[model samples]
Structure formats: structure tokens, C-alpha cells
Target: MTKPTTTPAEPPYLRIVAAIRRRIADGELLAGDRVPSTRQIAREWGVALATATKALTTLRLEGLVETRPRTGTVVAGTAPPTASPALPSTPSASPVSSASSTGTAPEQELTLERIVRTGMDIADAEGLSALSMRGVAARLGVAAMSLYRYVPGKDDLVLLMADTAYGEESYPADVPEGWRPRVELGARTLWTLYRRHPWLAQLGPISRPLPLPNLMVHGEWVLSALEGHGLDPTRLFDVHVLIYSHSHGLAVHLEREAQAEAATGQSDDEWMDSRAPTLQWLAESGRFPAFTRIVGSLGDGYDLRLDALFEFGLAALLDGLTPIIEGREATSR
Candidate 1:
């Protein structure tokens, strides 16, 4: 008798891709319809966020879906290419193979710096939530297990990525004349980093700060600026926290807006426009007269310009702190 043969089970991500592909084929999901987001897929399938991301990536590669700026990922308007076999779970040996083909660099070429940089690139393009060990490995063209040889896991990799990004900027050796200018420079430098890496703002809470060496550099800059002022140690630290909070609080919205756009398939302007009816209702209700008046006064809709807001808020904060720093006020609290 011939030996019994058994087929291998499909990977979770490929299973997800097949389900979605079937929906598209059956006409249940139309070309322009928004597909389930990575989060949604994860929740529904009881799978990891990484798996969901991989499924979406596979679909995109197969030309079954495309991303739009204001709109989230939707089925491609054009016909998809001829069906292809599911991607293998492991990296393929053949150079001309499908998605699993080894990356441009061989496995031996992998280094911690290269891995961290690749992770940063992914996090830069997609929000932090989209990042995964598997995704990074796939991009690097190595097996997922190969990454463990360098960074232990995703958490450690993210920390390395954050540290590297923070280390990009440094304070000048010759400081500005006044404490205010020096403080301004430090705050602006941090803001620039946050602007470049919006995901940085989402790292941790105020109580539990990330213990990154490069982040300490920025902290040192701010503390030095406020140190010689007449304020006590407590007040000095308090003011530093306040300044840092101002930059971080505003920056939190940067990643949030990106995530929201991806999740809801709507831009800020588009989201606001969708709420027009609610706004009109609120205006006519006569309950919020001041709000209605101010909103109505604008010839064009108010544009939420974050950079302008940052500058305005920074100026106001500094002006308020001037008296405290100059010893004109008894206490900042």
C-alpha cells in the first residue's frame, strides 16, 4: 500500500486573505467598499495584529486592493490579476519565487542596526500598530525566526527604533544667550522629532516614561535651561514637565489623525464635513450661542493648523513663565 499523504494546514494570514478574496468574488464586497481594518480583522478572527496586516499586504500585492489618501484600503477598481497560490509560510529558496522570496540581502547580511532601521521605516509609513516582527522579517526577506537572533522581540525592537530616532538631533555646544531661547530651542527640537515620528508620542504615559538614553539628552537640555533660575528644584522640574507636555500633547494628535484616517477612511476635513448636519443642528438649537456665533463668523471653515497652534501655545506658555523665571512671582503653583 502507498504511504498516506496529508496536506499542510494554511497559515492564519493566508486563511484571512482567502476569506476576503471569497467575499470580493461573491460580490459581497464591492470595489469601492472599505475593507476591514487590521484591528477589525484581528478582533473578528481572534488573530494578532501582525497577521491581519500580513493578510492585507498579501491582498495589496496581488492587486486585489489599493489604498487611497482620504479613503482607507478598498478593493481595486480594476480586475485583479489571475489567481496565484497562497504565499508560503517560509522564505522560498528560489530567487524568482513569490512573496516569500529572500530579501535583496542574504540572511547573513542581517544586523541589529539594519533591522531597527527597517522597523523604523515601516513604523514611519504605517502607524506603530501596523508594525510586527513578521512584517519586518518579510520586508527584510528573512524568516521571522531569524529576527530573534538580533532583537529578542517586538517590544525591544521598538525601543531600539525609538532610541535611534531620538538620537538623530543634538543640541549645539554654544547655547543661546537667555534661558527662554535655550528652552525654546530644546522644546522645538523635541517637537521636530515628534513631528517626524508621530509614533514617539504614543510610547508611554507621563508617570511611566521611556528610559531611552537619547530621550535623556532632550531632558538634559531643558533642565539645564531652567536650572539657574531663582525657582526651587521642585518648581524647576515642574516647569520642564509643563513645557514638555505642551509639545507632547499636541503631537499625540498627529498619530491619532493618521490612525483615524486609516480606520475610518476619512480625512479630518472629510470627517468634519460628514458632521455638518450635526453642527447645523447644534447651531439652530440656540443652546450654544457663543460657539455658533464664533463658528459662523468664519468666512471659511476653520482650518486646524497644528504648526501654527504649536507656535502660539509655545509663545503663550513662555510669556506666562517669564514672571516665574524672573522671580517676579512668589510661586508657579
Candidate 2:
């Protein structure tokens, strides 16, 4: 006997939306709680960014969630109430609130600094993609065009935000004793800033760095460390750039990990466990003998510790630079 055929699955976005809706209805997600970010949704569901965005848009349309300026997208204070059967409804005698009638605030005490700070807060919480003039206006209870008067455009506003974020911390008044220690301090300082604002890592690529003044301030710290080491101008600048790249290279993953955790609603280890099937397949494949041996030896499991990795790589990199820094030729040694 032949079995009956089942219907094809719903589209991915619809599935995601339904899942989030169920979570809300089940009390797993309370009002005003942050929902999974778009990047998070994409990473968690193994769907395209657009699909995750569409799911979020659908939830917004349904009034299940809202975008708050400094807080990203969160569950709406109240779900859109269900519609009841229409009776002979009568109009209300009282008038609606004046603020509600106009759909805007009567007066806005707007400022450039306020706008930039709002943009930074949004970027810090939700990431760069969630930022826009319109969103800022919505948060400020003003028209979107009003922001244009204070800030030229999104690009200009982003530059200001970057500078402000980078300027949060300052280097020491007196530099460290040794060149190596000074460089280490500078690198760690930048890493700490990135830890505070992970979204900073998703900025421009290495070749196209931002011309923000505060960024140059951090550069000065690194440059001063390598200055009196007898290296040529090109070599000094190159070494500084390489050191900056090392911090940034590892830093980018901080934001990605945050997105993943939010989307999947799981810790790093839990997420790794979800992918155990693939790991098992790779181990059994035996094609990669080295990889198989490494996994085989791990009776418990290997923990991917980024902080430890960073320290390890930093030491290795500085060790390799020791020869050049000490003005010693490898052939002579």
C-alpha cells in the first residue's frame, strides 16, 4: 500500500515568525523583552539575512514587537488585541488626546549631540544595520527630516558615532617602560573598547579606515611604542598596522557570537552541541587524519576560548617580532 503524501513545508520566514509568536504566547518572551536580532535570527535558523528580516517585519506588522532606539527590537508592551464581532458601535463623545491627534510631539528640544548619542546607542545595542535617521526620529518623537538639520546624513552621523565611541578611554599619561609592554598596553586598550562596543568591529575594512580624530589618537599610542626601535619609517608604520589588524581580526567575531547567541537563544556550548551531528560525520569520514586524531583525543570536548586564543596569538606574534625589535639579524645569531 502507498503512503499519503504530506504538504510541503511553510516558507522559512513564516516558520520563524510563527516560532517567535508561539514563544511570546507561551510567556517565554515577556513584553518589553528584546527579541532575537535579525543577524541572530539568520544565524540561528540557518536562513538568509533577508529571510530573518522578513520574519521580523512580519512580527512588527502584527504588532508583536517594536524597535526601541537604545534597546533594539523588543516585544511590544501589549500585543495587538484580537478583533471581536462587529456590533452597532457608537462613536465616543470625548476627543482623543492632542498628542495622539497630531501623531507627534508639540515641541522637540533637538541637538546634534543628542542625535549622535541616540545613533550610537542604537548601533551599540542592535548593530550598524539597524541604524537610520527615521528610526532616530521615531525614538525622539519628531519627524525624520528634523534630524537632517542637525546631522548632514547617515554617513556623517556614523563618523561622529565612531569618534565618540573610540574616545571613551584614554591612554596612560606616561608610557610603559619597555617598547613591548607599551605595545601590549595599546593593543589591550583597543580590545577592551571593542569588548564594550562589539559593533565597532563591523566598520570599514583595513584598507579604508575611518578618518575620525579619536581613532588617530589610538594610532598615536601604538606608533609611539614602536618609534625609537631603530626601524625605518615604512617598517614602523607597517608593524603598527599589523598589530592593529591582529586585534581587529579576532574582534570581529565578538559581534558575530553575540548575534548567534541571540538568534539561537543558546550559549556557545549549547550551540556547538546542536552541531554535533556534523562533527560526528567529519570525525567518521577519516579523510582528515590529523583532524580525526585531534577529535579522538578529546574525550570530553574542545572548548573554543577566544580570549585564550587572543593571548596565545598575541604572545606568538610579539615573539616573532622580538628579533626585528632587538636589532639582531637571524643569520648572525
Candidate 3:
């Protein structure tokens, strides 16, 4: 008799979490990679928003995904948990080298991946704020001027960084078996990648929609998802744009909170605590009864549940477009 191979059993949420965790451990999901939006997770895992949130929360607690200001939850790249442990204990100033210690021209040895990977390390440990031509050069122990040879300038470098990070995700090309499945998969793929490098959200809309060749497959996947929907080309464009906006809009908050924490070494809750006096004053004054009622719900303990908000809004948008989607399906058939 052949030996039986048994699959491991775990809860739905853990299974979902493990899927993400496995990617991270496998290096397929790199550092500074954005965690999937709760909506994306829910759709991918066929779980409820609450369960999805629990999965992301677990990742955040594990130091896997870090939220940054103007960015979203990004991969925490497995750098030393305590950076101080690795930083030079005593400072000594040496003229920063533009070339490696072996005296080889840094630019000559530079590959796109090398430049990007070094830059990512800086971003992961510090942040985008600390990333610049000179900063990345210093990290790589090369001359700041040498980085310019490859990067052209900081703006180009940042763009390349965003583009490179966006490449980490894999999108299925044949389009899923069903329109709904295809669309859900496309959105989840983009959202998962965005969750890794939330900074991509801040990079804004791509005017050409094909500037990043690597991301073209992703765009095609989204466009294909709308194929059977009764939407005209214009409406199809609008639908994809709407979904894209929703993901980035929520990501902006995640990025902001992450940046704030980095700057102050304080949690969002702590920052909110300092503002309590003002909030309390206003609440007690009762100048606006409606404001008081709503403000109470928005507390320091309150989180900007991006996933929940995304799901709620996405559902509403998709629901509202049902006639358009169904009409397209009917006409096609």
C-alpha cells in the first residue's frame, strides 16, 4: 500500500495568516512589501473581514508588516529588530568612499538589483525619508557620487524603487475562470503587492497605464476582469480607477501613522492620548451633540481599519455596479 500523505489542519484565519507568512519566509515576499488590504485578504481566503483583520493584526504584531507615513503597511524586512544593536557603538568620521574598499568603481559593479536592494535596506531600517543618493551610497560603503551614475537622481531612484518593489507580486495571466474571480484576484494581487510597499500608493496614478512593463500583466488582469460587465470602455476605466483609488486612499493613512511612529517612537494610541485633553474638553462642552456622539467612537484605541473600510466601500461600489456588470455579461452571452 502507498503511504498516505496527510495535510495539516488549522483554523481558517491561521491558514490565511500562514499563506502570507510562508511568502515572507520564502523571500518571494520581500521586506517593505505591503500586507494585503483586509478586503484583499477576505477575498483571497474566503474569510470574513474580522478574520482577515485578525490575520493582518497578527502580522503587525510579529513585526512582519510595518505601517509608514504616506505609505501603507510595508514588509519589515528581516533586519535586526533592535537597530541600535547593529549600529556603530562609537562614532568615527571617515571620508565616505565613492568606490568599494578594493578600489573598484562602484558604478561599474552596480546592477539594477544591487542598487535597488541596497536602497531597500535603507528604507526598511530607517524609511523613505532617510533614503537619498548619498544615504544609500553610505550604506553600501560606496561613494555617494557613484550611486548617481546608476540612479540619475533621487527622483528617478525613488520611482525605480517603487517600480522595483511593485515587481515582487505575481499575477495570473489567463484571467481566472470567472469574471468575479478574475477581478477579485487582480485586485487582491495589486493590493497584496501594495501592502508590501505602501509607498507605491503614494507614487500616484500611472498616466500611460503601461509605463511599467512588469506591472502590465497586473493591469491587463484588471481590465480583463471587467470584460463581461455591461460597462462601456469608459465605465470599465472608471471602475478600475475607482478600485485603485480606494486601495491607495486607505494606504495613505497607514503610511502616515507609520511615519508618525518612526518620528516620535510612539504608538498611534500614545499620540492620541496627548490629544485627549482637547477631545475631552470639546466633548464635555457639548457645543455639538452630533460631534460628541461620533467623536466618542473615534478614540485613541480606535484604529483606522483600512481593510474594513476597503471591504465596506468595495462591496458598495461593486453592488452599485451590478446592473452594469450583469448587463455586460448578458450582452456578451
Task: Point out where model 3 deviates above 4 Å.
Answer: 1-108, 205-210, 294-301, 328-333
Candidate 2 regions with alpha-carbon error over 4 angstroms: 1-108, 260-270, 330-333
The per-residue C-alpha lDDT of model 1 at residue 321 equals 91
- lDDT of each prediction vs. the true structure? 0.81, 0.75, 0.64
Q: Residue-wise lDDT of candidate 2 within 183-236, one digit each (tens)?
A: 898888888878777778888788888888999998998888888878899988
- The top-ranked prediction according to TM-score is 1
User: Measured by TM-score, how close is model 2 to the native structure?
Assistant: 0.68
Candidate 1 — which pairs collide?
103-141
**lDDT for 43 (candidate 1):** 84
- Ordered by TM-score, highest first, the candidates read 1, 2, 3
Off by over 4 Å in 1: 1-102, 331-333
Residues 1-333, candidate 3: write the lDDT tens digits. 999999887878788878899988998778765567666677788876667766766777787776554335567764333322121111210121222222344455765556666565465445667788887776666777877667788878777776666666666545457666766666667766666655566665545443676577677777877876557799788878776666666776655566787674335543454455677788899798998888787653356667777778767767776667778446656
Task: Estimate the Cα RMSD of every predicted model relative to the unseen true structure.
Answer: 14.3, 11.6, 17.3
